[model samples]
Target: MTWVFLIGAILSETGGTLSLRMASKGGGRAWLLAVAAGFVAAFAFLTLALDGGMPLGVAYGIWAAAGVALTAITSRLLFHEPLTKVMALGIGLIIVGVLFIELGAAH
Candidate 1:
């Protein structure tokens, strides 16, 4: 299903972003390889979602929003990163915006 592929893309993108952070902190070759694989798989999954007839705007919006929210939460859990209330509010807004995009696409 398109939703399945979109979720896959979101998870892969979030993993890729987290891997990038690790690689930046000297996680070295293995983490770097993970980063590359994650992103590549993300794009592949995204393409599959679009090929399954999901609209580009809707798919990309959801993917980007979910990726940011997931990455932020995971970063805080894994790396003691700062996720202030303001940032959380921003993420909420992004989710709302993506919801609007999806709703509009249905019309």
Candidate 2:
């Protein structure tokens, strides 16, 4: 389903972003390859989601917001990065905004 593809896109994008962080920290060729693959898979999955009837605005909004939030949380866990309360509040706002977008689209 579209939702399945959208979830796939979100996860893949998050993976790509995390891989980028790892590569930046001298993870080298393997991590770079992972980054490329993750991003490629992400776009492919996103295309599938759109093809499967998800609206462009809604799909992209969810994908971008979820990817950002997931990447930030995962980075905090894996790399001991700072995720301050203010950043958390911003992520929450992004989710809330996406919800509003989706709700508005239904009308």
Candidate 3:
């Protein structure tokens, strides 16, 4: 289903972003490859979701918003990165925006 593909895309994108950070911090060549694979799969899955009748605006907004929020959270959890209150607020706003997008599509 479209939702499945969208979820895959979000996870893959999050993984890819984290791996990129790891690679930059001297993780290993494997980390770099994981980044590449993750991003590629993310795009492929995104394409499938679009093909499955997910609106471009809605699907992409959800994908980007989820990816940003998730990546920030994961960074804080996995890398001890600083997640300031402002950042959390921004993430909340993104979630709200996505909700509006979804709700608007219902009409």
The best candidate in terms of TM-score: 3
lDDT of 2 by residue, 1-107 (tens): 99999999999989988999989999899999999999999999999999999889999999999898898889999999999999999999988998998899899
- Tell how far residue 30 is off in model 3, in angstroms: 0.2
lDDT of 3 by residue, 1-107 (tens): 99999999999999999999999999999999999999999999999999999999999999999999999999999999999999999999999999999999989
Q: Any residue pairs clashing in model 1, and if so which?
A: none
* TM-score of candidate 3 on Cα atoms, chains taken together: 0.97
Pick by lDDT: which candidate is best? Answer: 3
Which ranges of candidate 1 are over 4 A from the true structure?
none
TM-score of each: 0.96, 0.96, 0.97
Clashes of each: 0, 0, 0
Clashing pairs in 2: none
Residue-wise lDDT of candidate 1 within 1-107, one digit each (tens)? 99999999999999999999999999999999999999999999999999999999899989998898999889999999999999999989988998899889999
